[model samples]
Target: MRWLDADEERAWRALRRMMIAIQSRTAHDLAAAGLSEPDYEVLSTLSERPGHASTLGEQAAKMGWSRSRLSRHATRMEARGLVRREPDPDDGRGCYLVLTEHGLRTLEDAAPAHLESVRRHVIDRLSSADLSALERIARKLEEPT
Candidate 1:
């Protein structure tokens, strides 16, 4: 087995810890806005799309989630009147997850606080060089093997 050497192991551990810390802090910040991370993700995704709607499959793919998982979460959001599903006009077998007025309002309200939280937890903590290095690392990781 190819084991991580001392330097690699330290870097890996630091990366994991940083990610967990950021995620926890961000989640806590979102909770104050009356939204969870998943709620923010779904609402934001729909809001960014044209007509504020997307097919379940498309959204799931975009979010790197399973269709079933997104579908179940959509049901919960729908129950809360944050989103709604409509029959797809072009595809009889599929439906589009749409952002409702309530959803848009909720997202709009939460966005400012969310942005501040992100800046506080991440952007403000990093220098321009750090951000550039992070972006390079992210792009490298995202490249196909």
Candidate 2:
């Protein structure tokens, strides 16, 4: 097996720790707005789509989630009146995940605080050069092998 060298190990560990710390802190911040990370993800994703809707498959793919997982989460969100499933006009076998007015309002209310939390946790901590390097690294990592 190819083992990471000392420098690579340090970099990987730092990235992992940073990700976990940021996610934990942001999750806590989102909770103050009555949102979990998944909830925020769903709301934000739907909000970006035309008519605030997208097919479950599409959304799942975009989020890099399984269809079943997204479907289950959608059910929980629906129970809270945050989102609803509507029959897809073009696809009889599928449904679109549509954000409710409540969902939009909730997202609108939560976004400012979320942005603030993000800034406080990461954005404000990084220099322009750091952000550029991070962005380049992230894009490179995201490229399909």
Top model number, lDDT: 2
Off by over 4 Å in 1: 143-145
Question: Which tens-of-lDDT digit does each residue in 1-145 have in candidate 2?
Answer: 9999999999999999999999999999999999999999999999999999999999999898999999999999999999999999999999999999999999999999999999999999999999999999999998889
* Candidate 1 weakest ten by summed lDDT: 135-144
What lDDT does the true structure give each of the candidates? 0.96, 0.97
RMSD list, candidates in order = 1.1, 1.0
Clashing residue pairs, candidate 2?
A: none
Off by over 4 Å in 2: none
TM-score of each: 0.95, 0.96
| Candidate 1 local lDDT, residue 43 | 98
Residues 49-102 of candidate 1: C-alpha lDDT, one tens digit per residue: 999999999999998889999999999999999999999999999999999999
